[model samples]
Target: MRPIVVTTMLSLDGVMDSPGGGEHPRAGWTFKEVPFEEAAYEIKGREQEEAGSMLLGRVSHDEFAPVWPTMPEFEQYNAMPKYVVSSTLEGSEWNNTHVLRSLDDVAALKDSDEPGSIIVHGSATLAQGLATAGLVDRYHLLVFPLLLGTGKRLFSTDTPTGGITGLSVLESETYANGVQKLVLDVVR
Candidate 1:
């Protein structure tokens, strides 16, 4: 079985929206607070190397598909198998992309004989749903120092009370730019 890892860039207040420039009011906040660090890229590259596939929600897929394909840095990512969990999307124009209609499809993907990790990036809704359903095996969070008080957060009050999940910190590292990287395993 392959591990489903959810990776995200979050703010101190838990906001994960628009870590890069986008439509959010607090968009580009991460760039403002976190300086460019070669270590960050090295860490991300390592993760990418371990991943066999990439899973994304509709919004995230839409946001990434157009730009990532054109970038040299994302050449490997663009080449990997991409799965988008979206009931509405009938087909995908992106190369090596597949559409999964439901959570059951996601579960099946995890159970499949895939060779390496199935990594998710910037899929806030998908990540939360996976976490709530206890489908997420690990969480790779790069927590930025700044707080955007009013934006979409990683964890919200809407999470089910009885379904609280525990996480074991597998690794933690603080960068020179005050960005903290936490690798957590879901304590299921």
Candidate 2:
């Protein structure tokens, strides 16, 4: 089975929303000021290429579809197959994108002829659902500097992560600006 990775930009306080720009409360900790000199963009791009498809939440898809389609540099991403997990969204305006209602869509992806790793980006809600269904294979966390004491967090609640264990740190790179790129795998 292809690897499933969760790629998210997290603040020091583990908050993942509005770090750079979003409608959510940014708490004056927007990430544009934090220079990511660690080749973060390059790394993410490489990973995206290897991804068989991208899984996203409705909110993220709504926010991303408009801007990502216009950026020529992100053409590859725009062309890639995308799976948007949403119960409300009926159709997608973007290319090579599909709207999924249940976890069965993701299950189909795992059994289909699709190749390469499947990366889930900026979908905390979908991530939670995938986590519950045991869909995620690994987590690629990019921990940035600066913390938002009170904001939208990835792991907002104090719930057990399905007894996650056998955590072996894979790769770590500290940026010149103090951000840390960490790759972790689940040994199962």
Candidate 3:
């Protein structure tokens, strides 16, 4: 079975709401605090290159489908297989997109004979669910320096602390922009 990895940009307070300028109250907080650098793009590109498929929740799928397709930088990502977990979504118009009706479907994907990592990006709800289910294998977190006092956090209150124990830090890097990248493996 392939690894199920979750990559997210979060604030110092663990808020993962809007890392890239959105409708959130603390919109653009990430960029406002840390200047964009080549290392950041390099890190993101490396993740995209290593991923065989992307697993997203409805909210993330809707947010990305409209924008990523139009951008030239996301050409490779758009070509990869995308599985969107949603009970309400009937279909997807985006190329290479599939709908997953339940968490069982996600489990099936992980168990599939896929070649590379199944990366989950910007899906806080789905990430929480995966954490609760003890399905997350690794986490790649870009932690920004600022703190957004009120927003949807990466680790919600419902998440049991026991679920995240025994994590082994694989890598820890501090970028030029003050954003810290922490790669952690969940030791089961």
Candidate 4:
């Protein structure tokens, strides 16, 4: 089965809102800081290598489809297979991408004969849904030191809960700029 992995940017308070403290949410919270350039590069590279395909929600797909295609650093990702989970999106303008209309399809994808994992990034709602549905196999939360205290939250709803556990601590490291990346394996 292609492992289902989630990679997200979160705040110290466990809030997955805008890391960018300004008007742009989750903007400045990334490794865009001058000191975090090398660290960010390494992390992104690792993530790319670890995943065989990307599963994006509507929001993240909209945001990523426009920008990632233009950035050379993320060119590999743009070329990578992307499965967008969206009910409204009838078609995709991006290359190497397909839209999935139902959450039920997740299980079949997980069982795909893919070489690598199916990774989810910046899809808080979808991530939460996958976790609640007991579909996720692993989670990578990159915690930054700062907090906006409000914005996009990781857990969007409270109704579907109590599906995740058996988290084996995989790796944790503190960066120079206080961003700590924690990788966890969700034991099934």
Candidate 5:
């Protein structure tokens, strides 16, 4: 089966929202609150290089579609196939984008003979669903030192793990700028 990886940036308190600017009051906290270190963002380049396709939820798709395509740095991702999991979103104007109606579609996509991993960018709701349904194979997390104390978290009390899910750390590093990179595999 194709691997599904949830990749995200989080704060010390586990807040994962508005790392790169969103509707949150503390949007853009990643750059504003934390120091920018080139080494800290190396994971992004590696993820972009390794990911075959991208998967996003309606919110992230709406947030990224308008800006990512215009940015030259996102050229590689802009060319790859993108799947947006949204029941309400009817269509997409983004390049090579496809709309998936449900998590079942995500499961089918994962079951397909697709090459490389499906990298999920900024989709907390979808990530929670995937994790609860036991679909996420790996996680690429970059945790910053600052804590906003009031944003959407990566893991919450309501997140129901189907069973005892263990995460084995595959790789880890603490960047000079205090960002921690953690690559964890979900042990089934």
Candidate 6:
């Protein structure tokens, strides 16, 4: 089975909302609040190199589809298979994009013979659903040092009833800018 890896940016408080500027008042809090360190973002390049495909929720797809295609750093993802889970999205102008209607579709994809990781980025709602359904195999979190008291969070009340535990840390690092990179495997 292909591993579904959830990769996300988070504040110390766990808010996963608007790491990249958006409609939220705390939009762009990641770069705005924390200092930048090139080394802290090295994982992004490695993720692109190792990813077999990409998965996203409708909101994240809408937010990234237009912008990522134009950025040199995101060029590799433009050609990769991108599955967007949405019932309302009719189509996408993004290259190699597919729309999935339900979590069942996601499960089927994970069951496929696809190699490498199915990387999930910036899709908090979809990430939560995947976790609740016990579909995620691993997580890549770049945690900033600050806290956003009010915003969408990654580990919230919606998590699995007992809450997530048994995470095996695969890799971890703290950058000079105080940004932390945590690569954890969700132990089954």
Error of 4 at 76 (Å): 1.8
Better of 3 and 5 by TM-score: 5
Model 4: per-residue Cα lDDT over 1-188, one tens digit each: 88898888787766765453334545666655425635744666888888889999998888778778888887768888999999999878888999888778877888879878898988778888888888888888877777656776776556464366478888888877777878898876
- TM-score per candidate, chains pooled: 0.95, 0.89, 0.95, 0.88, 0.96, 0.96
Residue 170, candidate 6: alpha-carbon lDDT: 94
List ranges where model 4 is wrong by over 4 Å. Answer: 19-26, 31-37
lDDT of 2 by residue, 63-95 (tens): 888888998877777888988988999888999
Worst 10 residues of 6 by lDDT: 156-165
Candidate 6 TM-score, true structure as reference: 0.96
RMSDs, each prediction?
A: 1.4, 2.0, 1.4, 2.5, 1.0, 1.4
- 109-135 per-residue lDDT for model 5 (tens digits): 999987789999898888888888888
Once fitted onto the true fold, the runs of candidate 2 whose alpha carbons sit more than 4 angstroms away are 27-30
Say which candidate scores most in TM-score: 5
- What Cα-based lDDT does every candidate model obtain? 0.86, 0.77, 0.87, 0.78, 0.89, 0.89
Q: Select the stronger candidate by lDDT from 2 and 4.
A: 4
Worst 10 residues of 3 by lDDT: 158-167
Q: Residue by residue across 41-148, what tens digits does model 6's lDDT show? A: 999999998899999999999999889999998888888999999999999999999999999999999999987789998888899898888888888999999888
List candidate 6 stretches off by more than 4 Å.
161-164
Candidate structures ordered by lDDT, highest first: 5, 6, 3, 1, 4, 2
Report clashes for each candidate as comma-separated counts.
0, 1, 0, 6, 0, 0
Candidate 3 — number of clashing residue pairs? Answer: 0
Clashes of 6: 0
